[model samples]
Target chain A: MTNQSSWFETAVADLVDPQDQRVWSIIVSLFGDMAQEPGAQISGGALTQIIEPMGIKPEAIRVALHRLRKDGWIESDRIGRVSRHVLSEFGRTQSAAVTPRIYARDSAPVEHWHLLIAEDGTGTQVLEDVMLSDDYIPIGRNIAMRAGAAPLQAEGLLALDISPQTAPKWIQDRLCPPELRASCRALLTAVQNAAKTHPEEWTPTPLQSATLRTLLVHRWRRVVLRQPDLPAAFYPPDWVGPACRNSIIRMLDLLPRPSAAILSGSG
Target chain B: MTNQSSWFETAVADLVDPQDQRVWSIIVSLFGDMAQEPGAQISGGALTQIIEPMGIKPEAIRVALHRLRKDGWIESDRIGRVSRHVLSEFGRTQSAAVTPRIYARDSAPVEHWHLLIAEDGTGTQVLEDVMLSDDYIPIGRNIAMRAGAAPLQAEGLLALDISPQTAPKWIQDRLCPPELRASCRALLTAVQNAAKTHPEEWTPTPLQSATLRTLLVHRWRRVVLRQPDLPAAFYPPDWVGPACRNSIIRMLDLLPRPSAAILSGSG
Candidate 1:
């Protein structure tokens, strides 16, 4: 392999998450990033070409596809001898739900925030229901917060629309845990380093671009989706969420989104 | 008794709190209302003359005075044949703390209010401490609210400075229970009825004026002090707090505070 090709391989190794390698999740990220638009489809060969170089075997990709099909997240079709996959209606809805937050360059710093507090023990289930269905972040056993001016319809809970003043250590820790902070910091560092070493004059071929984009979107999806979208006050003192987000956006901008034609090798 | 004297007697009976006639607490209310100034004293005979018409025997008055002395609330002085009682410094301090709220002609609406929520179960103790020391009204097991913009220095508790938008039934009931509302409504009705029948031209003797003042203060104190001082939203829909306060103030205005010299029989 040429030096440039070796650098590309090393970059992929550095970018992919070491802790989570669920192939099904990786394929979901792939579809969410590239083929989320209606009628967008990826040929079977193109899917292998994009994901296999991340050290996943073709059989692993097939198994992940089988699982995705079984879960009703993707539908498969055959034209002549080539099989292609498209996001199912369920998959499209799920992807659309988070697409704005994941792809937003700058989220409109959640203007209005409210809190919901349950009674100590018996109200635990009520607060849990609000947290799960209403996008509330639980700050304590009986306390949860969400971004909105409108009060939640929690019957036994006290709701307060608040402008957050000071977030202490425990609240910061609860909202952004140590592990999440570390993951964000790790991603920021990797993306920054990759950007630094990337050659300025080089133009990647379609296959090369596909490989890089897959790795970038896969890692970013893990970090971005895991983060609680909140105002700056909610993050820990040393959280690198903003830096990681900026770095992820800058890196994705560098690797322009390849058209399905280019990714399918028909350009 | 003449017609006017009979009217005075009936008015005194109507004004005294039917539920609570604790003589010691009545004396506290008298001192807090008419003699809160430092060096203020009430002659023992005058104290009896004022409270005796509330149907409490002089021996009961002596027993209540004994209890008050034992509780560090009052001190006694004797010079030859006359005895006098004065609120102890501790008693004065305790009485002064709630006097303004109890006697104010109009309570300035609580503009800023805040809620503090502790973690369920384990955090009950923290919230309890805040409620005991601060002016927090406990609305739920883990939730308490207080008036002010100042954030409480309660660690591990989620504090939100909220301008109440809406308060539901449970919170309203928690802050102003049925018993409190009934007490307020009863006081309002009694004071309104007394105000209607009071003879404007009748000039009361100093002792009669003292008796009227003591009865009004005693009943009003029971209602006012029992209330959790919170914003209007916290009260029940049928709450008569404002009406009771208005009636009490009007009644108290009619029964002007007698001079200490009159109360001491030395005017």
Candidate 2:
């Protein structure tokens, strides 16, 4: 490979998440970023060209595609001599649900927050139910929080409308675990490093841009989706979520979304 | 006894707490109200004159005095034919602690309140310690609240400085139990009834005034001390604490505290 190709490959490796490289999840991120539009399809060769450089084997990609098809996330079609893949309706819906949060330049500010406390023995199970269905963030064993006003009907729990003023160390650690903080910090450094050194005059073809976008999105999705969208006070003091978010958005803007025809027809 | 004596005696019986008349506790209230000043004393004859109108027998008073002395709450002096009683230093300190809460005509509005939540098992002990030492009021098994800003140091608890916007039924009921609400209502009605029927022109000697004051203070202490002083949101819809407090203070104003000189010298 040329020096230019090797430089791009090194950047992709540095940008990808060091902890998690689940082939199926990477594929979901790829499809979510590239072909999430209705009826959009990427040729099989283009998918391979985008993901193969991330040190993923074609056999692994095949296995992931098989799983995605079996799970109704992707559908495949053969036209002439080339095979094409597209996200199924279920996959598209799933991607649409989180795409806004993952890709938005700014996270929506959660205005009102409330706490629900369960009783010691029997009421914990009820609180578990609310946490599952509602967007409740579990801060402790018996306490759950959600963004919005207190629920009108809290049958067995003490629901309090609260605006947090101070969060002690234990609460901060519980909400933002050490591992999550590390992940965010690592991603922020990696993206900031990539942004700092990239050549200003470099304009790559659609396939190159697609490959970079996939790695960036894949790494960010793993980190961003693990934690809930909570108030800033919920994060640990050393947390780098805001910086990571800014870097991710800025990098994605640098590498604009490539069209399916350009991605498939070139290689 | 004359008809006038019988009338006053019946009125005293009507005003006293029907649920409880623990003699030792009543004596404590009497000492706290009339003789809490350093070096103040109630002579034996005057004590009997003040409390016997509540229909307690002389032997019961002796037994209560025995218990109080044994418990280090009262010290007695025998000179010639009369015994005198004064609160011990420890008893004075204890009485001084809650006297302000009970006797204040106006309840201070709790402007800022916060909730401290402990972890399910281990942190609960720490929270219990804070509750015992601080002014924390337990609202649940692992939760405690107090007035003012959140503490600067909450090691293992989720300390949320909050201004309560709405309190549900369970919280109100938990903080103000049904029995307490009932007690306050009963006191409010009893005090109002006594005030309504009191003759405008009747005048009493120091012994009669002390008897009425002791009984009123005794009954009010039972009801007021059993419940925590909390914000209005914590009270039940029908709670009559404010009204009860008003009536008790008004009636106490009507029946002034008799001087120790008059109490000991008259009888």
The DockQ scores of all candidates, in the order shown, are 0.47, 0.49
Highest DockQ among the candidates is held by which one?
Answer: 2
Candidate 2 lDDT tens digits, B1-267: 865565567668778879778988889988988999888888888888888888888899999999999999989989899888889999999999989987999875464788998876777898999888887888767888888777767876777776665566777777788988888788788778777777777666678888888877887888888766666666778988888889889988887778878655433
- Candidate 1 C-alpha error for residue B209, in Å: 1.5
TM-score of chain B of each: 0.94, 0.93
lDDT of 1 by residue, A106-133 (tens): 7555647888867656778988977778
Report the lDDT of model 2 for residue B57.
89
lDDT string, candidate 2, A1-267, tens digits: 865666677788788767768899899999999999998888888888888888889999989999999999999988787888999999999999999879978875454689997766667898999888888887767788888788766876877777665576677777778888888889888988877767777776688888899988888887788877776666677988878998998988988788768655534
- Model 1, range B13-111, lDDT digits (tens) per residue? 788888768889888988887778888889898898988988999999999999999999999988887888888999999999987888888875575
> Which stretches of candidate 2 lie above 4 Å from their native place?
A106-112, A264-267, B1-4, B108-111
| CA displacement after TM-score superposition, residue A108 of candidate 2 (Å) | 8.1
